[model samples]
Target: MTTADDFRALHERPEPFLLPNPWDAGTARLLAHLGFPALATTSLGVANVVGRTRATRAEILANVREIAEATPLPVNADLENGFADDPAEAAQMIAEAADAGAVGASIEDHTGDRATPIYEFGLAVDRVRAAVETARQRSVVLTARCENLWLGVNDLSDTIKRLQAFEEAGADVLYAPGLRTLEEIRAVVSSVGKPVNVVMGFADPSITLEQLAEAGVRRISIGAALSRLALKSFVDGAREMLAGRFGFVGELPPITELQQAFD
Candidate 1:
């Protein structure tokens, strides 16, 4: 089966599975070697590595290609806002992402304009529809994201409305990244008939995988959390060194283990 088919099958499993986002090829290979079923590319992670606030389609595709080449696991790309305000351009971006070896991709409703914050509801739905059509032609899994939660619009009712509309627009999976409570997550999953992908960072500590599965989540992704954690270690180690402490090196994985992981 193609990686796209394999990725689609992952959502059909009896329980939800974790899809960790890796920032680079090395991290992708290491995560695959550590036994993750699939991997995702974090746009935030990509932006950070490239020393920019945002990444262009060409940059994202390059990262996607590198990750796909580094591991056997299927790779999903975070195609933020589809890289365009026009539906046709958004659809074209999805096609390009598929060409870069992404088995799955996400298109968010955020417009990238701080003043406007998000696309109007009608336009957002159309954008997702266009992307979904393109993904269908390419056999790539399309994830439609509602950015209300992340865009400072913390309205659950509206978020549900957008997700439902996106589902009708033919999105294979629905996602809203900033949901904080199980009640909110379950409500989204129950309202959308399709598979729901939930972001799993800064979530309620009481919530567990079993709880999420029981609530009907089909996929869980840690977008940029792994990358942030890796950066946290580096920053902390550097700060300690500036304070005359070099103990952070002891926390590093053995050199032999690193070599073996890549081997």
Candidate 2:
């Protein structure tokens, strides 16, 4: 059984773990075949697949259960913002997530607002604390996300300060999604001594995976890059066909690939 213990063990490995986010069963199985130590579900991808704007608590749990049942790899549920307005409600959702077979999960501090993107600091900490307490009962590893960088706060010192508080509040992993610079990443990794998850796709140039590992990043994730890549290919190919560039539509994936995917 791929239990929470298995997910916890990945962190103890010497090299920084790379977990690709998958939305559906096919993607999950492919990731498992790729020998990933674990897999994570992307909320945006799930929402898009289901033709919904966002995920409800019920929908996310159902999806988590489906992905967990489809693969043996430890599955990490991206429980976006905990899916609740109240801390207690969020904690309850975390327990439900564990029941659905999530080995671990993340609770973001983003408010989904452009103007005021992140939650109030104190409330965010309380929310993370609630999630940790709930997950502790099931031994579900809880990751706390600080969205300051993603929201363009761009203050490394403040980001470290918040993450240190999250670590104290019982987060097993500390993540800042938009951190691109080595200095910011190193500072966060150094400040709390907790495993950090950085987004693989970065703007204004980026540090390589090896360099990030040296800089002390313990995990790397490509949030929705795969989905974007797939969409880009489809859109670009259609545009070429419409513009009488049929020859440009070269050989796509083999039929065997699709058959095996469903098989």
- The candidate scoring highest on TM-score is 1
lDDT of each: 0.90, 0.82
Q: What lDDT tens digits, residue by residue, belong to model 2 across residues 139-243?
A: 898899988887788777878888899999999999988887787778778888778888776523457878878988888888767766766877788898889
In lDDT terms, how accurate is model 2? 0.82
Could you tell me the TM-score of candidate 2? 0.92
* Residue-wise C-alpha lDDT for candidate 1, range 90-159, written one tens digit per residue: 8888888888888899999999999998899999999999999999999999999999887789899999
**Could you tell me every candidate's TM-score relative to the true structure?**
0.97, 0.92
Judged by lDDT, which candidate is best? Answer: 1
User: All candidates: CA RMSD in angstroms?
Assistant: 1.1, 2.0
